[model samples]
Target: MPFKTKILFLCTGNSCRSQMAEGFARALRSGDMEAYSAGVVRHGMNPLAVKAMAEAGVDISGQSSKTVDDLATKEFDWIITLCGHANENCPYFPGKARRIHAGFDDPPALAKAAATEEEALAHYRRVRDEIKAFVQGFDINAAG
Candidate 1:
C-alpha cells in the first residue's frame, strides 16, 4: 500500500495554534493524512486549545506538546508553520517536505489580554474555526 501522507504542524510554543491545526486536520483528513504537531520549545498543550477544539467537535485532550528535537527523525510530506515568528524561525526539515506558512494570531495571548474568561474563550473559538476552514482547503501534495 502507498504510504499515507505525513504532515507536521509547527508553532513556537506547541501549545495552542499547532495543536489546534492538528486537531482540525485530523477531523478533515483522517486516514488520508497523518497529522503531527511540534514546537521549537515544549510549552505544554494549551487548555484554551482543548476547549476550543471541543467546541468544534474534535477532541484534542490527549495530545501533548512536543519539541522539534523529539520529532527530528520523522519525515513529513509537508511542514506547516502556523505563527509568523515560528514560520521565520523554523529550521529545515530534511526529505521532500514542502514547507508552508499560514500565520494566525495567538489566541492564548488574546485571552491573556482580555479581562473575562468568556471573552478569552470567544477569541479561541474564532481562531479555531478560522484555522479549520483554512486547513481544509490546503492541497499539500500539489504544493510540493
Candidate 2:
C-alpha cells in the first residue's frame, strides 16, 4: 500500500483559516492523509471555527492551538500555507517536505467586529466551505 500523506496547514494565527483547513482536510482525506494545523504565533482555537467544522460534520472542538515552534521537530510531507501572511513568514523545515500556498481569508478577523453573531458564523461557514473545496480538489500525487 502507498504511504499516507502527512500535511501541515499553517496561518499567522492558529485561530480560524488554518483550523478550518485542517478540519476539511481530515474530513475529505481521512485515512489517506493526516492533517495538522498550526500558527507562527499561538492563539486559542477560534470558537466559530469549531462551530463551522461541527456544522460540516467534523469535530475539531478538542484540537488545541499550536505554534510552529511547538511543531519544529515534527516532519510533514507537505506544508500548506492557509493565509498570505503565513506564506510570507513561513519558516524553513528540515526534511524532504514540499511547500504549497493555498491562501484563505481570516474568518476570525472578519467575525471579530461583526454586528451580529449570525453574520460572524456565516462568514466562518463560507470559509469552511471554501477550505473543503480546496482540500477535496488537492491532488496528493502532485505533491512531488
Candidate 3:
C-alpha cells in the first residue's frame, strides 16, 4: 500500500475555517491523505463550524481546538494556512514540509457583526462550503 500524504491545516484559531478544511479533507480525501488542523492560538472549536459542516454531511464536532505547539513533534507533507494570521506567524517545521498559504475569512468575526442568528450562520456556511471546495480540489498526489 502507498503511504498517505500528511497535511496540517492551520489558522489563527483552530475553531472554524481550519477545522472545516480538516474535516472536509478527511471526509473527501481519506484515500490519499491524512488531515490535521491546529492554530497559532487555541480558541476552542466553534459550534457554528460544527453545524455548518454537519449541514454538508461532514461531522467535525469531535475535533478539538489545538495550538500548533501541540503538533510540534509531528511531521507533515504539507502545512496549509487557512488564515492570514496563521500564515504570517506559522512556526518552522524541522523536516521537508511544504508550506502553502490559502487565506480564508474568519467566520466568527464576520458573523459577529450579523444582526441575526441566521445571518451569522450564513457566514459560517459560506466559509464552510468554500473550505470544502478547496479541500476537495486539492491534489494529494501532485503534492509530492
Candidate 4:
C-alpha cells in the first residue's frame, strides 16, 4: 500500500551471499522493499546456500542465478555489493541507484578445506545469518 524501495544485491556468482540477502529482504522486508539479486556472472544456485537458508526457515531455492544483465529492470534505489568482485565489477545502472558495498565471506570458498558436509554447511549457515542481519538492519536512506 505504501512505497516499496527497490534494491539490488550484487555478488560475484549469485550463488550465496547475494541470494541470501535477497531472500532475507523478501521474507523480512517485503512490505517495504522489492529486492533483486544477480552476480557479475552466473554460477547457478548453490545447494548448500539453499540448505543453510532452509535451516533458518527461509526458502531461497526458487531464486535464480544470473548476471546483472539478466535483470529486466535496471533501476534500483540501492545497489548493495555482497562481494569484492561484484563491487569492483558492478555494471552501471542509469538510474539514481545509490551504490553500497557490504562484503561478506564466500561460503563455498570458506568451506573449501572443510572435511565434512556438516563442516561445509557451517560456513553457509554463518554467512546466511550474517546476511540476514545486514538485510534487517541496513538503512537504505543512510546511503548517500
Question: What ranking emerges by TM-score with the best candidate at the front?
Answer: 4, 3, 1, 2
- Write down the TM-score of every candidate: 0.94, 0.93, 0.96, 0.97
lDDT for each candidate structure? 0.89, 0.87, 0.91, 0.92
| Candidate 3, 18-108: lDDT as tens digits | 8999999899989888999999999999998999889999999999999989999999999999988998999998898988898888999
Please give the lDDT score for candidate 2.
0.87
Off-target runs (Cα >4 Å) in candidate 2 are none
- Compare the candidates by TM-score and give the number of the best one: 4
Off by over 4 Å in 1: none
Candidate 2, residues 1-144, lDDT tens digits: the string is: 757888999999888888888888887797688888899998898888898789889998988899998888889999999889899999999998899998888887888889998989988988888889999988877945
Candidate 1 residue-wise lDDT, 9-79, digit = tens: 99998999999989988888876778999998899988878988998899999999998889999999999
Model 3 weakest lDDT span, ten residues long: 135-144
Please write out the lDDT profile of model 4 over residues 1-144, one tens digit for every residue: 899899999999998899999999999999888999999999999999999999999999999998888985668999999999999998889878899899999999999999999999999988888899899998877845
Give the deviation of candidate 2 from the true structure as CA RMSD: 1.4
Clashing pairs in 1: none
- Candidate 1 accuracy as TM-score: 0.94
lDDT of 1 at 101: 87
Backbone clash pairs for candidate 3 read: none
Q: Residue 105 error for model 2, in Å?
A: 0.8
Residue 125's lDDT within candidate 1 is: 92
Pick by lDDT: 2 or 4, better one: 4
Model 3 segments more than 4 A misplaced: none
Query: What lDDT score goes with residue 12 in model 3?
Result: 94
